[model samples]
Target: MTAMNTFENKRFLARIRGGDFAHPGEEEAIDLVLSHVKPQPRETVLDAGCGLGATADAIGKKTGAVVVGVDLDAESVRHANATYRDFQFIPGDVTKLGELALPKMDVIYAFNSLYACPDLDACFASFNEVANPGARIGVFDYIAYDAGALAATGCLPPSVHSMTQMRQLPERQGWACTGIVNLDLAYAAWYARFLARMDENREMLAAVRSPEVFEAVRKRYADMLHCLEQGTLGGALHLYARA
Candidate 1:
């Protein structure tokens, strides 16, 4: 599996987020994913690109499923192991999951993580290899609505896809997309709350992060807000089953 430290702002991000998640409304998103997947006890589940194992730990506790998280960052894996002892965190790459000696997963989910994958088709193909029959896949991620605006922000990964492409690509890779929930409004609301939280903790953040870092993070959020408001970018929750 490949390992790289792509999340350079992870520490400061954790501080601003007040947790391990990289996006807003993470808890609610987790609940939504879990409800859609409905993992069974004793089933093995995979949290691809799990950061700090927060969502993985929550999944394990809630479903009594044997949950394992994999990420490309060894430091994040080490931190996750130390912090969330109930679940296992390993250093690996999501695109190469077929090569990992892990148990077949009954449910696989990625929350705002798949965008980093350089090849979505290869990733899904590997996922199919590691999945048990009828296994479900849940992903919640940003969808590009206006290509020009999305490119202008330069925040999203180069591999980011449109909502139609996201659904189509997975289906072509042998997964049947059963549902697609548009979360654009919810995303906007989350950003609104996130900005408010940042404002509320401005002093604390300023003390921990440099002025430049603080401003950069704030600007990134502001840009995202603008994109959402302009219908340039959106969010979606997708559910799929092995075909």
Candidate 2:
């Protein structure tokens, strides 16, 4: 990835941690991920891009599994480590998982992480490095392109893979889709909450985002709200894939 891309990932991670779009309730998406992964006491798990270590903490505490979360942002790593004592949070690049000194994991959760990875092949292969045979890989994220407004976010370029393309690409990387769940209601609820948050902190939001960028984001949100109200766009997809 380019340096600019790496920087963009960091900015995106910050937005996630700030609860602008990634609210506390986004844990519901993670809940869907954990539901498919029945962890054993001795199992090791990895939560890639684990902002604030919320999912990692839940999984680690619940299953008594050794969970290690990785993220490219030092702030996120620091935040996660400072907040969650039981789960380990490492500052590392998801694109280079082999260099992270992580153990083989029985399961890897990539909730909202794959979208930031430009090289799908390399990103998926990185998961293979830390995954044991037959390991479960669960991901909960927005299926873009189909979500008209959601796709127009400035954080994401328009050239990336659509939701269908993302789903198909995993199979090519040696993963088999075990299950899929529709997350329209959750996404709609989150979007509503996000807009309200923006309203509550409009000045702060405007200070960080330029006028043009803010307008673009607003347009994207408007398109999403319209599609959401009309029930045309696909909301979100929770995938359980096995490596």
Candidate lDDT values, in order: 0.82, 0.66
How would you encode candidate 1's per-residue C-alpha lDDT over 134-156 as one tens digit per residue?
A: 79999888888887778788766
Q: Compare the candidates by lDDT and give the number of the best one.
A: 1
True lDDT of residue 95, candidate 2? 73
Show model 2 residue runs off by greater than 4 Å: 1-24, 147-155, 197-235, 238-243
**TM-score, one value per model:** 0.94, 0.75
